[model samples]
Structures are given as structure tokens and as C-alpha cells.
Target: PDIELHPSDKAASFSLVLKGTSDSRTTAYKDPARIYGSSHSEFTARKRLEITANGLRALAAEVKVHETNNEILGADTDVGGLFAGMARNTAMKKARERIPDAEALAARRVRERVASRLNQEVDASVTSINRRLRQGPGAALEQHGLGPASLAAHSTSKELVVEASLLFANQLAAGSPPAALPKGARAVVQIHESAVNNAIDQLGLAGQTIEGAHVRERIAQALAPVFGTSVKLPDDPEQQAPEGSITFAARAPLRVRFVDGQIEVILHAASLQRGNLKTPAQVIRARYQPVLAENRVTLRRQGDVEIRAAEISPEVVSISLQGFAAARDAAIGAALRAPMDRVFRPQINSPKAFTITTELGNVVPLEVTALESRDGWLTLAVR
Candidate 1:
């Protein structure tokens, strides 16, 4: 539904009217249930906005001052000055409400959105979808692309509920209880009562939204792009993925990130070891960070040992070398003259193999499984 706003300087002038449904039938978003329900209310957009509260505060404060000055002017000035005061007050009031508190609120909203995806929402949503995909009469886990060894697995009969459901307040707390009733949830999601509590015990949720433009860019990456604006899930629920192939405009640089997957790589260019570093570092390191988990790699350099740039599976497990030694890319450039200092391992497992290659692949076997993996994204294929 197209909403054509009347440009007027009065509270009475700015009011919303729903075009499609009765007042009783609208969703909490006041959206009518239509198959093609593309039209969303401005109120709905404002709800997700991080700065709505601050804008309201700024408005109330500014308006009180504006109205008060108009009164003082009426007492002291000529009718002309009084009329001018009224006009200024009206114009300011209209502009103030119309123009959102973009800067301060934008910053806060982005933080909230990223937090929702990372700390609160993304995991729940993935669980919901995975549950739905898992459902069926005797549905095989392989049908959903999951093998039997998926650590703890969800049953095929299970269903899940995941949605953004815009709200201005009480966006569910970090790890709150499951939603009491599912709204606008798909039939694919069979979240019923008796099992709801149990499911909540088994599953988890985090809060999230599309907030900062930069945050939006990150959300787009961590979660794949659904449309121009919507986000889909990454391969790993607990990991933040990089923006796939989105070009950034000069005015708006694209930054790929997510709420909880704080995987980033930084590089310093030394004329001694300067390479096409920063961009590649962020790219390659993220490629492996999900593999690195939260652990830092501590290399023991007996004397300038060779390191190979390795590949992580698209699902972030099992590194299949395009045959290892062919990877001559400089993993690090340490001179043997300096008594060979190993790159300090943070959460990195101590990988020692014949030449760090061979089938032992040293770090590859040790770093790939959950027992040795850090943070939340690691798995080992049970033999």
C-alpha cells in the first residue's frame, strides 16, 4: 500500500491510515494479511530504528522550549513579532518530527542490530529453519545435508520459529524464553506448546536487526543477502562470514560483519615484508578464522620453518590441500638471523608434523575438530 504523506505543520496533519484491512485484523505491525503484503508502515520502520527513543526525547525537549518562547514573544512584542514566533514554532515542530535523529540514534541502532544477530537472534533463526528442514516422517538427516555426526542433532519431527517481528520495545532479552505464540510464522515451523519449553531448553536465540549502514553491510555478509536489504544465515551459526561479492560505492564503503563472529585480520606493511596485505589479510584470515576458532596460533620456530597457506572447506571443516607444498605463499617472513622466533599462537593448537606437511598435516588435523576448535564453530566427521 502506498502511503502519501500530507506535508503539513500540525500533529493532526501527520496521521497514519491503513488502506487494506480492518483496524482489528492488522498484525502488531498494523500490516494487513495479504499474500502480496509488501507495503510496510513507517511506524514499523521506526520501531527497528535505534534512535527512535532519543528522537522522541529531543523532540519533546526542543518543542517545549519552542512553545515557551512563542508565549514570551506574544507578551512583549508587536502582533507581527508574535505571528512570526508562531510561524517559526510551527515550522520547527514539523521539521523536527519529520527529520529523524539519524546520527546518534543511528550509532545506537547499529550496535543493537549487530548485537541482536550476534548475541541474540541469528542462532535462534538458524535453529528454526534447520528444525523445519529437519521435519518429516522418518526424514533422513542427510536429506537436510546434515550427517549423523552433527554433535547433538535435532529430530526430524521438530519444528522451529524464527522471525524479525518489528517491535519498538521489549526486543527479547539475551537468551530469553521462546516466544509464547508464533505470529506470521510459516506452517513449516511447528512450534507447539508442550514441546515449546523443552525445545527452548535445547535451542537458543539472540536478538538482531538491520541497523547501521556499516552494520548493515556486515549483516549482509555474515548472513547472505536475501534481497537488496534482507540477510540470510551464514554456513556457521556462531561465526560471522565475509561479504560475498558486493561492490561498495565510493560514498558508502561496504563492511562485512555479524553480531558474535568477531573474526577479523589485520596486517602491517613492513618494507621488509610488505605485500598486498590489509584487504587480503581480512579475506584470507576470515577464510581460516572460523577454522582458527577463538584459538591463536603459536608457532615454535626452531629456525625459519616453512609455512603453507591452507584452505578450509566451504562448510569450514576438513582442509583439502590443492596438494600442500604448492602453496608457497609467505605465511610469515621471519629471518633465520633473528634466532627464529615462532609466530606466537593465541588459541592455535600446537601442530607438529614432519615438515608441518605430509599426511600428518600437523595443525590441520589438530585445528579442525571441535575438541581442538575454539568459540562455537568446529566439527569432526566421525569415522
Candidate 2:
């Protein structure tokens, strides 16, 4: 490839053609990987081709720089001849002669270079998406108070779509989902995971669900002597245990389920662990609704926000939160102890107050209709 650059005040430019031929008997040798059932030979060939291509590019650049210098310094044509002689020295001649087929190698390099460039462009385009905008509908939007924490992008004919299950993790203000983009431009997006996680954290539930069998297993593990080798319990999400008991240690994943004005928790081993048990496995089947409520704290799902005693309002450019005391304490602790986790956190907390905020940068207005829960994320739907 040859390129010409116009002279600037500080420099001059020259066009140079990389001359090479692609016909070579050496490449007739089959890449060993194709025969040996491995890709090693193919990889080796690609590396060699890249190295050769880069060397040629450097050589061409050096020649151009010298040419520019000669023109700038007001040197005559004789100086150009001197540079040509130096570039065509014995080493250059031998390097060219040693190559089996320069043109064939250059051809491979061109294809690889073009493919690399396209891959880079695709990555850049996908990463450009704005978080608050571009939520699409699917099974990912079947639940309330769910919004995508991140997106996995795949290219389409003119836009990119996420065909996989997307996890949502935050609350959104009740309104239309944000629009995707204008036409005739590369479609891409960025997701705000931390912002969503913060909004969802107010609920104290974070949509965590565990089956009864899992709870049983955890209890058995805690009381290994009484439960023996294995433990069994119901696997249904809505099913509860009756007339059973088991003990477990603290810090097990406690799940809270809210139905009407009541709250039920599973995997809570605090009460059972206090007594000695003969039927340890059988005791694990009891499901008790706990009388747990925080003063001035409300847990409810509205659109994409899980209410946990906070005042949140969504605007065209930003979502505002006030008086989320619990979320504030947790975030501050996380920031002070595990500061590394906040390195890429997009949601910003105000030092002056417990108010948190995040903004949508330059996106079209769209309506958000539904939110669904996925593992670690919520999916948002636009209508």
C-alpha cells in the first residue's frame, strides 16, 4: 500500500509504493497444522507474516522521513540519491532475496490487517452505548423492578442486539424506556452496573432466590454429625416446610420473601441451632414467617426501582436518590474497606449528603414498560 501526505509547516511528505510479488514456490508447502490436526503452523505463519509486514512499513516510514528531511533542509537531488543508495544497501537486498515470495506474504498481511481493523471497530461501536437508554424487551423483561446491569452485544445488519439473557440490577424511575439511537450511525452502548446495583440495593432483597433443597443442604453441612451424609428438602420456590427443624451457623445466605403484609425467610438457622436434635434432617423442613420490619423502611417494587426507604426521582439526564441511609452506609463501608471495587464504579455518591446520582448522556427519549430479573442483572424493556 502507498500513501501520500501533504506537506505541513514542519514537515514534507512523499508517497512510496511497497513493491513485492505474491508468487512463491515456498508457500506450496502445506501448513503443517492442517495435516497434523493442530493450528500451530497456521499461527506461526500469521506471526511471521505480521512481522514481515511491520518491517516493510517501518522501512517505508524511514524512507519518507528522510525524504521529508531533505526537502525541508533545502538539500539538492544528490542528497536524495545518497538516501536511495543507503536504503538499497546489501542488507536490504539480501533481506528481499531471502524471502520466498514477498507478494504472497504481503497479500496475507493485508487480509489479516483488514480483519484486525474491523474487529477493533466492532468493539468500539458496542462500547459506545449509553446505559439508561437502549433497554430492549424479551424474557429478560418479565419481572418488576429489574434493569440490566450490563449488556452483551452482537452485531446486526445495521445495529447491534443482545440476544442473550441480560441481568438487571437497579431501579429506574417510572416512565418510558430510553430510545436506542438515531439512524445511519454505528449502534453501541455502555451499561451502568454500579448505578443500577445501588438503586436495587435499597430493597435489601436484590432479587436473591434459593430453593428449599439448597437450604436443606446448607443445614446438613452445618450439622454434619446429626444429618450424616446427605439432606433432602423441597425444591419449589413457593413451597414451605412444615413441622421440621435444623440448626446452622451464621452468615449463610438468608433469603427473604414478601407476600402481602407478611415476610418469610429461609436458611435462617439461628433458632434451630440453639437446641439438640434427634431428627435433624426432618427438622429442616419447617418454614416460619418471621416478624421482621424496619421502622420507616418500606420494601416494594415499582417499575425498575426496589423501594428500600429512599426517595428516588428519574429525570431526562439523571436519576436522583435521597435519604437511602442503608445504601449509604453499605456503600461507604465498601468504599473504605474494598476501595479497589470502586475503581470502575460509575454511580457517584455525594460527599456532602447521602444523595446518589447518575446521568444518561445524550440519548433519545423512550418508554420503559417492564423489568425482568436475571442472575446478577435486570433486563429493561422499551415500548
Candidate 3:
């Protein structure tokens, strides 16, 4: 058997050719003949058969995509075992012609036996292949929300080819087509920024308040350099404040935007408190350059986080110098940077985050060969 592959921008084609030959010899008794007082004469029959089964036209499958349910239904052209039957018939005709006594009943029996065995072999091979397909790639595709949109098979001078177009289930409703796999890459997964934001939303990060004694302490420490006084952040908003201490709290959901080859994280609102006085909400914007190394992808902070202050000033703390707008913004940005880094680093930098575990319990470590963020999409090419 020979196998070949042809790949195009939209689809991939595969070809298989099965060819073999068999020989057999049979000893039988002929009709009674008077040969030196012998009642019957014996003859040896030999037959050599050559078989070539081309799956170019015989083996074909079509996959219909059901986007709503995220399912793929396959329709095989050889549902009736037509290819196996044809191969059996061809083998039988050739085997019978090779036999010395083609018209003999014995020859007919031999031909039938040869054809039956060939048919069984062909049928078994086809069945086994189909079973493996269903259990292997088929299962993987379904698990990953991938379905074939179009399937076609054809033959060239030297090969039989099967071509298919595949789609991602989640992208169908958005009318977004799958990107072409990069040259020499085994697979490519394109993640849109919107999908990332949606996942964040599903996790209930939006409107969620992040506050704790340890969290407040960390932020307070980060602000110490600019405040010139040790800050005390209350763990709860309603808790009584210590004298001259300032409280800071940030609210999510954090939204991400991919553009200009970077990931921009926006924290919509943060508030600063000094006793009963609280400043208006502020926005924090952070940008990161995504970096891929070995099997891990991580984000490197591009620069200092941008702090957008509201009309009310955060410099009203009695322990700090008043009316210094720039100093207040810098203090808030510095306080949030470390906590944000802690939140994102572990999530994206781990190698296990990108590893794929297959249904057979095999771990496939993905080595990201290329990473690109453009046009609101983050694409990763892996081998």
C-alpha cells in the first residue's frame, strides 16, 4: 500500500493505493483415462492472481456540519461495501483465467474460494480503517469543536486524493472562517480577542470586587514610596479606617483587546479612600507584548501602566502633600501593577497551559513555533 498527501489553502487531500499478488497450486484428479492401466489421471493446476484496488473513487466521505449543535455527520460513498465487491470480482476473473482447466467445476470452486478470501481481507481492512478514524481524529475533532464543511475525493495519474474543508464550531455563528494552517505547521489555533473577553465574562470577573487584607496590604506597600507615609488599606469597604490611612479597591471585569501586536488589558474602575472621603473612579490600562518560548507563552509588560484619573483628586490624604495630581496617579498605578502581574503571570506563562492531553491519555506538548497578534486575533502555530 502507498499513501500520499496534498494540501491546499482551504483543504487537505490524502491518497492510498493497495496492490498485491497471490499464487496457488492445486492437485486434482481428472476424468478416467486409460494410461498404463491407470483408472484416472492426475493434474496439477497453478494460478497466479494480481490485484490492484484504487480508493480514489471507491472510498469517499462527506461531512455535513451542524453549527448549532456543534456536530459533524459523515456520509460515506462506500456504505454498501461496493469497493470490496468489485475487488473480489476482479480477483475471481483473473484467478479463473490463470487456471489450466478454466471450464472445470474444480476451477469454479477455486475461483470462488480465492474471491471470498480477497473480499474478506479488503472488507476487514476498510472496516478497521474506518474504526480507527472514528476513534482517533474524529473524536479529537469533535472535542475541539472542529467539523468538516466540505469533503471531496478524486484521482490523479499516480495518486488518489481526498480533500476536505474544516471549520471551527464557535466561529460558524460569527461567520468567521478558520485561518489557513501555516506551512510546515501541524496545527494552528486562532483565538479572537472577543472570545477571550467572553470567557472572562463567563468567569464572573466583571463587576467583581477584589479586596482582602493581604491584597490591601500589598497595594499599601506599593504606594508607600509616593505617599511618604505608611498606608493602611481596609479589607472591607464598610470597615472603620485607621487614622491617616488610605484605602484602595479595584473592580473588574478586566477586558482585553488585541491590536498593534500587543494585548491591552483595561481595568475600568478603581477608587481611593481617605477616611470618609473617596475619590471618583479611575481606569488603569496595561499593555503587554506576548512572547513565546519553547512550550510556554508569556506576556512581558510593555511599559508603565496608564492611569486615567477622574475629576476628584486622590491626593486629598492628610498624610500626603495635597494637590499633586501627577504624584497621585503614579501612586495608584504603581499600587495596581504588582497585583495585576500576579494575576496574569501564572495563568499564561505555564507550559502546562498550552499542553494538549488526548483522549488516549497521551500528553502532546505544544511547541509554539510562531505567535502573531493582529487584526483582533491571536494566532499560534504549533507542531
Candidate 4:
């Protein structure tokens, strides 16, 4: 099959809402310990933020300051200290309750104090998204994507609200389909073994090994767009079967295995080849490791699949090449690099959106109201 590639100037508009609560405790006065008792105040703030291509904006925020409790844990009839603690606690509580919108007022004061640091955080997040969507494989976002970024926030009696719009260059592409959820449908994905197996089969390696002579033909057919003119698979099995073909003994079996924490497609006795250098097939396993472990594929709970370093066992595995073992090992590792770094591993028969027991409504795309990871599934609420 022949295919043509074209540059896409298409863009997507989605809203990401982040909501959470923060708990804080601090000493009311710096020298409280010297007074034979500790006086401390505790506060809780509930914050909601709306983030868009424009920037991050506060939705609503609510803050509450608990009355100070100035009491010594152990005291030998320290009547003065006891009364002082009681009086201070009573006074603070009364003052806070007596005022209208006290929590909102307090939240405003807190926001003002941390405004500079908060703005910096928002800026940093926007910068990161911009950098990711504008570089290398991510550059498919086209040119000058994110626009006119700005942040706005305010406090209310119930909570503090933040709204941000990160303006980027975008135009509605012609006849673009809306990613709306089907009527009465939900947004939960269950990635089963069959779905994974099918994806692997699409790679044309279901019954073949990387060392096969015809591997390049299969790879070229599957990934012509990626490797392009530089594509090559120089290593061939020692025992040849036919021209541009691999021996039946060199074939490997592939299966998707579901383990305790994640799902993996294991290619038994797979071959790893870089140019003319070949390494053991087991060296090509894809374990979803963390981002810090950049050597391996960065697999997070987000369900996105990435290519990373496979595991290498201590057991002596045979190398096909006669010389340059160390250099060949490195070369083999480089060749097995992930073809697609970040891609949504879609679940078969997945829902468009989902509703959580805690949330009042269904979550959908365009507006991702909520996100939860439960029962090994990443559940998302969309609007």
C-alpha cells in the first residue's frame, strides 16, 4: 500500500480544570514556645482553577482559619497560661465568626501575600505546555500554537476561583469533527488484552522476530513515515531460509500479558538489531517506567504508551556479531528506541465520558470536569 503525508495545521480546543484543597498550620507568634505553651492556627483552603489555551484562571476559592489553641501539653498548675490560651482561642473564633464573608476575606489576604509566587507557577506551567507542543515529534501542533496567555483569580465566600487562558495560534480547520460524547454514553476506558494484542499485531511482528531478513520489509510497510529514507535492518539470521525471508526457527511469538500493576505485550525471544550489530531479543522489553527513569519508556497512569529502555538480564545471551560487543550493544540499544514516544493506547469499547460517585454530573471532552484513576482504569469526566 502506498500513502502520502501532509503537514497538518489543525488544532484542538480543550479545557482543563484543576481543583484541590490545601491544609496549612502555623504558630500564631514566633516566640510562642517561650510562653510555656504553644499557640498555633490551622487553615484550610479549597481552590478551583480553569485552564485554557489562553492561560489559567481561578474559578472559586474558600479559606477558613481555625481558632488558635494555646495550651501546654503538660503543666503543673500553670493557671495564667491556661487562661491566656483559652481567652485567645475564644477571641479569635468569635472575631472570625462575627464578620460576614470572613473566610472569603481571609482568602483574599492570603492570595495577595502569595500573588507573585502563584503567578510564577502559572507562567511555568504554560511555558512547559508550549515547549512540548512546539518541538520535534510534538511539533505537529504546527507553528506558533499557544497564544495571548493571561491569568485571573478571585476569592468567594465559599471558595477561591481562578481562570487562565493561554492564547496560542489556532484556526478552526475545515470540517473538523467535534469530539463530543455520544448521547447517554460514559467516559471510562477498559484496556483489555485483545486491544493490546491487536495493536501489536498491527506492527506486523506477531509471528516474526526482529532478526528476520524480511523484518525491514515489514517495518517499512508499517513505519515508512517514521524511518523514511534512513530506514535499514542490516542484521540477518545466521541460518538463512530464502531471499528476503527469515527462517521459521527465527520466528518469535508475541502476547499481551496483564500483570499486577500494568499490561505489557511480551515478545518472546524477540531480536534487537542496530545496523549490523544484533543483541538478545529479551533486551527489547517495554516496561512503563517513570519520567525520571528516562532511559526506559516513560509510562504514567495516564494510559499513554511510550518507548523506553527494555530490561537486560544477567544471563549470558548470544550475540550474533563476531566482534565489537560493547559498541554493538550500544548500537542495538539505540536501534530499539521507541518509534512513537507518546500515544494514547485506546481501549476497546471505551466510553466517551464517565460520571464519578462524588461528582454530580458526567465528565466529557471540551471541558474535562474531573479525572480519577480507579480500579486500574483512568476515568475521566467530560463536558
Model 2 spans > 4 angstroms off: 1-102, 105-153, 163-180, 183-383
lDDT of 4 by residue, 146-248 (tens): 2213434433332223332322234111121123323332232223343233333434454454434454355445433221223333332433422222211
Superior by lDDT: candidate 2 or candidate 3: 3
Clashing pairs in 3: 206-253, 207-252, 207-253
Per-residue lDDT of model 2, residues 11-75, tens digit only = 22223233322221222222211111110111111110111111111111221111100001111
lDDT of 3 by residue, 1-383 (tens): 34444443322344433333323333322222111110112222222111112221123321111111111111122223557555444444444453444324443444455445545554566556556555565554444334345454443333323444443334321234244545665556666665554433333334433443243354444333322245553233434323222233333345668789888877555554433544456665678788876556666777666666744535555444555766766676555554444433322353524577643356877667777777777677777
The model with the greatest lDDT is 3
Write down the TM-score of every candidate: 0.15, 0.18, 0.43, 0.27
lDDT of 2 at 203: 27
lDDT of 2: 0.28
Local error of candidate 3 at residue 72 (angstroms): 48
Candidate 4 TM-score over all chains jointly: 0.27
CA lDDT of every candidate: 0.24, 0.28, 0.46, 0.36
Best by TM-score: 3
TM-score, predicted candidate 1 vs. hidden true structure: 0.15
